[model samples]
Target chain A: MKIIRSVAEMQKETLMHKENKRSIGFAPTMGYFHKGHLQLIEEAKKENDIVAVSIFVNPLQFGENEDFGRYPRDEKRDIQLAESYGVDLLFIPTVEEMYPTKPQLNMVMVDRVDVLCGKSRPGHFDGVVTVLAKLFHIVQPNRAYFGLKDAQQIAVVDVLIQQYNFPIELIRVPTAREDNGLAMSSRNVYLTEQERAEAPAIIHALQEAKSLMENEERHPAVIVEKVRALLQQHTSAKIDYVELLSYPELKTIEQINQQVIVAVAVQFEKARLIDNIIYHP
Target chain B: MKIIRSVAEMQKETLMHKENKRSIGFAPTMGYFHKGHLQLIEEAKKENDIVAVSIFVNPLQFGENEDFGRYPRDEKRDIQLAESYGVDLLFIPTVEEMYPTKPQLNMVMVDRVDVLCGKSRPGHFDGVVTVLAKLFHIVQPNRAYFGLKDAQQIAVVDVLIQQYNFPIELIRVPTAREDNGLAMSSRNVYLTEQERAEAPAIIHALQEAKSLMENEERHPAVIVEKVRALLQQHTSAKIDYVELLSYPELKTIEQINQQVIVAVAVQFEKARLIDNIIYHP
Candidate 1:
């Protein structure tokens, strides 16, 4: 596997691949490889002539008070994991390489960011779209892989691709989960022993909400209250939010007749965990 | 020459060019072919294996009171002129084709805007960069051409390319002008015969400012005052603005020790005309 560190070099490599008519599949990620990230790479490896993975912890996506400085990174392990998955190229750009100077233009989200995690974390989606735009231009991937664990992010990417007309196919892999039904995440490392024990309740609450929706609980307000009560009764974690909205569009839905997302965020002693399930009624 | 009217078709055509290893040079313009637009096409024809021209009168760049509805367009003449220049592909997408839905994200200018024409036209640069971003992604030109007639635009494009790390190179063509020294523009058609005759004074003021700077006048205020006085005396036009600043950066400079831009705008009875000259000291 070839390890690339510079944006210019990666672009040149991708251009050569294009000239040779090779299909490139890309997986962009922050470091500290987890099962969820590996699932995305596996999907890419199966579909393309070359699979390229970028492991850059984008600083632009982190707010001033967010965990940017303490974001977990294990370069050696990540490189090994990616290589083991038969990734053809591994790009690990430094913060300086990704952003030599502050951008003079901002890519601001105009929609699909008013509920769920977006409401609690302002400017987070903007930071995400900006870095992703840069990555998409640099990689020029024929198709890019993103896990559905970040459902809102996938929705935002859909809008970006459609609006800008980027010649890329977005491939979404289903969320990878632990044996206990907790969604796999790199942030899982931040959890203490006690917090880790309580994290699975976030997913449990989502599953219960889905079951309730399946059992003819159509009102979003009722579903949200039941999910909140389940989290309160079962786990020591403080409820951040429990929201039900239209999938992808994230618009308010009065009744569950179509696809909707039931998402929850909970604050443990040392970690904030999030989980969601897309329901069709 | 092949004419593309759909964004999907244009993107596919560009993708085929990329796979074939052909270098594409792009010229983006509003319709109504002028000497300036032709000059840009001519330069593209010389350097690239394939020259592509897009004639889009982008509404995003026009203000509420501006002439967006009345923007000049002559498709038959434009197609003929582009074909004569050996343009391999001509992309003419409708506003609906370009923006099927209103953009859910906005690319906003953070700098290089607050001066010159940007001072009077708020959100104009935002609209410009937004459309350009979409065009660049769809066309995927190896190198894109822009005339330096709009100097601040070139500056904004410079930032956009650098910040996004677009793989395309930017080639700037010098401004094309009429014999009497008025910069050739599609809007030149809006001027009455008498107004057209006096419009050359905009360029004349720029030249006078250049000469003054060359003759050791370093203070921006003194040079601007002299240029304003010259325009007032030489033509029956309303002075919109006369300003001097650092080239590309568009920042105020105390002394003329480096490259600078002297730009002016004048409003006639029916048309608004602008011109500028870059000076090195």
Candidate 2:
């Protein structure tokens, strides 16, 4: 597989590929790959003549107080995983390589922002929109894959794509999970052994909420309180928020007659764990 | 030349062109094509395998009180002008075609925006950035031609392209002017016969400032005063602003030792005219 870094070099490669009439499918990610990311690459490879994956741990997306410094990264391991999925190119751009100079803000984010993860992490969606716009320009892919794990991100990206009229199709893969039902995340690596043991509770709470939702229990407040109580049982876990929101718009659901996402974020011993389940009533 | 109205169709056409190994040079304009806009298309035709011109009189860039309703537009005239310049494609998207849904309040605007035309016309730069970004994505040009007549706009576009890592080379064609030296503008249609006759004074003031700087007259305040006095003499012209600013960065230049732009804005009859001259001291 060809490993490219510079945007110009990637554009040149893309131009040649286009000249040869090769269809391109792209999977954009922040490195430290796992089964979740590999699945995306595999899916991309299935649909296009050439599959390219970009590993950019975007600094702009991280909040000032967030875990940007310790975000897990292993380029060697990421490349090995991506190549195994028959990826044709691995785009590994350095922070300076991706952003040679201090860039002017070019993209305008939508208002309301779905306000999911954006509530705790302000300007996060702005960062995501900015970087994704840049990537779309460079890759010029026929289709791009994104994990449903970042449900809020997918919603934001979808709106941006439609609003800006970017020539890309978004293909969302289901959120990959561990055997114990915990959603797989690069940040999960930051949890201490004890915290790791308690992390599964996030998923457990989501499942419990889904079961309650399925039983025709429609009170959003009641569902939230139960999830909050269950999460509070773990001494290491502190509930950041447990709320029921409209699936994609993420607005408050006055009545749970439509699709909804019951999501939870809990602070563990050394990290924050987030998980969610979608249900229709 | 083929005229494309829908963004989807334009993207498809662009993709088909790419697959055929065509290097597209684009000229994005707010219709009512003047000599300046035609020059950009001429440049595009000379440099590219295919030339695409988009004539969109974007509403997003105009303030509520500004002349959005009266913004001149003649698609037939523009198409003829574009075809004369050997343009391969003419993209004429209606407001509904471009924006099916109303845009959110959030938008992109450069930091140094409130210096020239930006200050006079509120939210103008944001509109320019938003529409240009959308056009760039839809057109996906190899190189985009911009007339240097709108000096600050050129700077804003330059910064945005760099920030977004758009795969485009910005070719700044020198500002095209009329025989009497007034910078050609779509708003020129609003000028009355008497107002139009006196409009050349705007260019004359700029030229005088350039001459003074060339002769070692370094005081920016003096230059500002002289230009203001020249425009004030024209009874029909209401001087909006006259200032000497550093080129590109657009910082207020107290002493003209480097490259500087003498920009002026005047309101005559119902039209607002802006023009500038770059001088090196």
Candidate 3:
């Protein structure tokens, strides 16, 4: 794999591929590669003539004291694995390179950022959309892969593409999970020994909620409350939020008749775990 | 020439050309085509295999009490002229078609908007960037054209292109003018007959300032003051502003040594006029 450290060269490379009529697929990450990252790369490789991956731990996306500095990195392994996965291009820009200039005066705050993980982390989706906007220009991808691991992020990306009319397709890759059903994430390394033992409970809670949803229990509040109780019972963590809202649109619904996302976040000692199940009720 | 009123079809049309390795040049306007609009279209046609023009009287770019409601249109003549000029595709989306959904919550406020015409019209450039962002996505042109008549707008477009990493060249077409040197603008239709006769004084004032700079005038304040006095002496319109700033950056300069823009705006009874000349001093 060819590793690029400059934005201009990356844009030039992508433009060359574009001129050659190659469909490029892009997967953007924050470096510490895991099974989820591999899955996204695989998805890209399956569909496009060229696959590009970006590892940018954008400071704009991290809220105050939200581990922007302490975000873990496994660069050597990541580079090797990228080659093994057949990534055509890898972009690893320094923080200074990514943000050479000071940020814009007024921020791009999203409209549907009032719920889910977005509720506690204000401006987080805005930051995500902003960086993606920049990266999309550089990569010039025909399709970009984003995991359903952070469903809110996927929804925000949808809005970004629609509102900006970015002529790029957003592919939603399914969450890569462990044997125990825990969602795969680089931040899993932040879990302490005991916290790691209890981490799988997040997915387990969501699975139970999904079962309830599948069984035709239609009260959103009741399902959310049950999920919260299950999380509290299965793990020693503070419940951040348990929400059931309309999928993609992400609005509160009085009755669960359409598609909905039942999501939950739990704050462990070191890591905050989030998981969700989207289904038609 | 094909005229696309639907955003989806326009996007597909552009994408087809993009995939076929045909370069597209784009000119975005608000209909009522004139010499300036023709100049931009001509520039686009000169360089690309495909040329696309959009006529959207973007409501977002108009401030409250602005002329959005009365923005002139000559749809039949505009369409005929577009075809006569050999435009490959012309997109004239209605307000409802262009804006199917409500706008995003938070606005994109630009920096360097506190001077010149931007000072009087707040959020004007923000609206321009917003609409342009959407249009750029749909058109997906290799190069986009804009007139240097609104120098501040060009500066804002430069920032938008840079900040968002839009992979499109901005072609700054020169301002097409009337025989007496009044800048060609659709808003000129609103000018009374006498006002039209006096409008050339704005350019005369700027020309006098340019002469001062060419003769080694270093102080922007002095040149600006002289231009304001000339405009006041020659035109019946109220002088909105006469200022000199760094080129493209649009910042106040200590002394005019590098590239700079000497810009002015005048408020007639029914129309506001803007003009500028950018050159190395």
Candidate 4:
């Protein structure tokens, strides 16, 4: 595996591969490598001649009060894990390298992005979209991998691709999870022992809601209330949002007549955790 | 010269040229091919192994009262003119073909974008950026060409390229002008016989300001007053804005020490025209 740092070098390498008629698959992440990230790389390896992964802790996605400063970083562990998965290129760009100018460009402006996680952390989606846009242009992948864990992000990115007509096929892998159904997230390391014990409640609530929907209990309001009650069992748990939205659009639906997604976000004593489940009725 | 309508076809053709390790230069414009548009293509052909031009009359850049509905378009004339310059590929995508969806994505959310033309035409820059983003992706040119006539647009696009870290170099071609110094624009067709007669005043004012700056006039207010006085000579012209700003940032500068841009917008009987001159002191 090649460890590339400069955007110009990466572009040159990718263009060579393109000249040889090789399809490059890209996996972008804020590297604290896990099974979920490896799964994305594995999938990319199967579909393309070369795989590229970017690991930059995007500061734009975190608000002033959020964990931008405290976000974890481990280059050694990440490099070993990525090479093990047969990554062709591992991009590690500094903030200055990626953004020479203070990125005054708001490239990821989308409609309805202001809802869901956007409502709580304003400009978070903008940051994600901006970084993703930069990565997309840098890598010029035939297909890009994004985990369904950030379900709202996938929706916003979908619009970004369609609106900008980026020549990329966005392959959304299913949400990777832990043994107890807690979605795999880098922030999961922040959970204290007690908070970790209660973290499963968030996933449990999602499972219960999906089960209820599958069994013909479809009132979105009732499901939201029940999920809120379940999370209330944890004393330190603070609900950010508990929504049962139409799949992909993230809009509210009274009943699940078509594809639907049940998603949740909560702030515990340790860190914020988000997870989701999609179902068809 | 090849005329292509489908993005897939163009991409395939471009890929073949890429396999030869040929550099691509692109020029994106709205149709009604004038000498200015032809000059860009001619310059691109000299610099690149492949020169691609996309003519799209983006509806997103048009205001409610703007001339989007009546904008001049002539594909036959455009193709004939492009052929004269030995163009590689001419991309003329239909509106339905360009926008398969309503484009739920808004690309122009840049700070200070709303100051000049952005303020006059709400969401105009958003559309411009959105369409340009699409074109950038589809054409995937090594160096993209933009004219200095749309000075504000060039600044915005420069930010777009920088902010997104798009792997393409931007070349700002000097503004092509008429013998009378009127900046070439497709919208010049909207000028009536009387409006066309008085149109040279706009350029005259810019020239007067340029002369003042050349003679070391440093005060912005004085320069603006001189330009405004020159503009007052045209009985049919209604001045919209006249200001001296720092280049790219568009911030008002009290004194010109470095590069500065003098810009003006005027409404004639049936059309609004914008022109600018960049001066370095």
Candidate 5:
């Protein structure tokens, strides 16, 4: 992997690749390399002539109380993993470089928010789209890889691509998870021994919700209540929210005849864990 | 010039040109085939392998009370003018085709919008940026052309291209003017014989301000007052706004040591005319 830091250099490299007709696949991350990160890189390498990975811990996405500072970092190990997965370009822009001044263009998310993680973290997805817009222009990838772990991000990004007419495809990869169904995340390291024991139940609750939907349970409220009850029974953590909303649209459905997501957020002692299952009925 | 209305076809055509290393110069306008529009196309042709012009009277940029419905368009003549200027592609997306549904991505301008036309027409620059974001993605130009008559648009667009890191260069073409010194615009067709006679004085006011600045006059308010007095004495139009501010930043200057702009908007009997002069000290 070739380490790159400046935005201008990255854009020049990508533009040269574009002129040569090489398909570049981009995998964007916040860098504490894990299985989920590697999976995205692996998928990008499989489908493109060049694989580009960006690892900037975007400060814009975090709220005042959220973990912007000390989110996570492992540059040495991240470089090793990226090189192992054959990443052609590794972008590591510092905060000063990425945002030399306050950006004049302000972006906001108008849809597919007001639910999931977005409900609690206002302006989170706005920050997300803002950064992604800059990155999309910088990298100019043929296709971009995103894991379905944060299902809402994928849906919002779909709108960004379609509405903005970005000449890039969004490849949705299934969420990389541990053997116990715990979604792989950098924040997973923050869980204490007791909280870690309870973390598996978040995914378990979502699985049950999906099973109930599969077996003809159609009432969204009923499913939500049941998932809340299951999580309450299994985990000592506080239940943040349990929702059954239509996929991508994230709207409350009276009849679950379309694709829906059963998502949950749990507040552990040290971290907030989120999990979801997209059900096709 | 080939006329394309479909977004998909335009993207495919532009993408093919992009891959083949053909430099695309985009000239976007709300068409009525004026000399100003032709001048932009002519300049675009000079700089790139392919010249693409889009005639979209973007509804997003117009206020509820603005002239969106009454916006002048002449497709036959506009097409002929583009072809006459050696344009390669002409994209004419209908309002419905451009906006198939409400866009999920929302953009807001946080800087350089509180003065000039942006202040009078709230949400105008936001919508301008939104449509341009879509058009920029679809056209993927090597350079985009804009007339300096709407100098604020050029300034805001400067922020857009810079902050978004768009790979396209912004070519600022000097304002095309009539023989009588009136800035050329399709909206000039709305002017009556008397209003048309009065329009040239707007440009005369800006020229006077430039001369004042050239003669070591530095107070922004002094230049603004002189321009306003000149316009009042020369024409019967209602002066919408008359101000002088720092260039691009659009911020008030205590002293004119930097490049500055003297802008004026006059509401004629039937049309609102805007013009500006960017003066370098």
Candidate 6:
């Protein structure tokens, strides 16, 4: 696999692929590869002639108080993991390389960002969209793969693609999870042994909410309260929020008649974990 | 020349061009074509295998009380003029087509928009960047052309291109002018005959400032004051602003020892006109 560090070199490689009429499938990620990122790369490899993976722990996406400085990065392991998944190109750009100049304009999120993690992490999606915009332009991929672990991110990308008319197709892979049903995340590494043990409770709460919805319980408020109670009772996790929102649009729904996402965020002793289940009712 | 009205069709056409390894040059404009737009098209045609021009009078760029409703549009004339300039594709998408959903997120301009026309017309550059982002994605131009008349716009576009890492090269075409030196603008149609006659004074003021700089005038404030005095005395135009700024960066430079732009804006009885002269010292 070819590894590129500069934007110009990466763009040139993509342009050559375009000229050669080869389809490129891109999976953009922050390093410290987990099962989730590998799955995305594997899916991209299956669909395109070239599967390119970018490992950029975007600083713009992190809040001032967030764990940007301590965000897990393992470039050697990440490169090996990506290569194992048959990634054709590995783009490992430094922060300085990615942002040569301080960004003057922002790709501000106007909608689909008021609920869920967005409420707690303001300007996070904006940073995601901004970096993705830059990467999409550089990669010029035929299709870009994003994991459904970040369903709100997928929704934001949908708006960006529609709003800006970016030519690339967005392919959403299902969320990768641990055997215990906890969604795999880079932040999972931050969890202590005790926090890791409690992390699955977040997913358990989401599953319980899904089961309630499956049992024809229609009231959103009731479902949310039950999930919140379950998290509060079973785990030492402090509930950040347990929200029932319209899928993708993230608008409030009085009754769960259509597709909905039951998302929960909980603060453990050492880490915050998030999990959600999308349901059709 | 192929005329496309739908975003899907335009994107497909551009994709075909990419697959065929053809370079595309794009000129994005608001309809009523003037010499300036034609000059942009002409420059675009010279640079690439395909020259595409998009006519979109973006509503996002206009203020609530601005002339969005009365913005000049002449599709038939524009089409003919573009065809005459050897434009390969003419993309004329309706406002509804361009913005299928009301944009909830905005490409907010943080820098390069606080002075001159940007101060008077807030959110104007944001709108321009938003629509251009859409157009640039849809058209996928190798090189995009813009007139130097709106120097601030070029500065903003520069930031957008640099920040977003768009693959397209930005070509700044020299400002097209009338016989008497008035920078050609579609808004000139709004000017009365007398207003039209006096519009040349805006350019004259810029030239006067340039000459003063050329004659070893070092103070930005002094050059600005002289230009403002000239516009106030010689023309009936109401002086909007006559300021000097560092080129491209548009920052305030106390001393004229480097590349600078002397820009001016004036309000006539029925229209507002803007012009600038870039000087290297």
* Ten-residue region with minimum lDDT total, candidate 6 chain B: B194-203
Cα shift from native, residue A116, model 6 (Å):
0.9
For model 5, which pairs clash? Answer: none
Q: Cα RMSD for candidate 6?
A: 1.2
i-RMS for every candidate: 0.8, 2.4, 2.1, 2.5, 0.9, 0.8
lDDT tens readout by residue for model 1, B1-281: 99999999999998889788889999888879988988888899888898989999998999999989988889999899888878999999999999898778889999999998888888998988888888898888989999888998899989888999888899989999999999998889889888887888888888889889889999999999989998999888899989899998999988888899998888887778888999998
DockQ of each: 0.87, 0.61, 0.62, 0.63, 0.87, 0.86
Ranking by TM-score: 5, 1, 6, 3, 2, 4
For model 4, residues A73-112, the per-residue Cα lDDT tens digits are: 8899999999888999999999889888765657545565
**Model 2, residue B16: displacement in angstroms?**
0.9
Winner of 3 and 6 under lDDT: 6
Instruction: Considering only chain B, report the TM-score of each candidate against the true chain B.
Output: 0.98, 0.96, 0.97, 0.96, 0.98, 0.98
| Candidate of highest TM-score | 5
lDDT of 5 by residue, A216-263 (tens): 998899899988998999888898888889998999889899999999
* Model 2 CA RMSD to the hidden true structure, in angstroms: 2.0
* Per-residue accuracy of model 4 over B98-208 as CA lDDT, tens digit each: 888765655655565766676787888777777888888788788999888888888888878877878778888888889987888888888998888788888888998
lDDT of 5 at B91: 97
Off by over 4 Å in 5: none
Model 5 has an lDDT value of 0.91
Sorted into a CAPRI-style docking class, model 4 comes out as medium
| Pairs that clash in candidate 3 | none
The sequence of per-residue lDDT tens digits that candidate 3 reaches over residues A174-273 is 9999898989988888888888888898888888888988898888888888888888888998999999999988999988899999888888888888
Candidate 5 C-alpha error for residue B132, in Å: 0.5
For the predicted complex of model 5, DockQ is 0.87
The alpha-carbon lDDT assigned to residue A53 of candidate 6 equals: 91
* lDDT tens per residue, model 6, B1-281: 99999999999999899789899999988879988988888788777999999988889899998889998888898888888888899999998999888776789999988998899999999999999999999999999999999899999999999999999899999999999998989899899988887778788888888888889999999989988988888789888888898888888987988899999998887788889999998
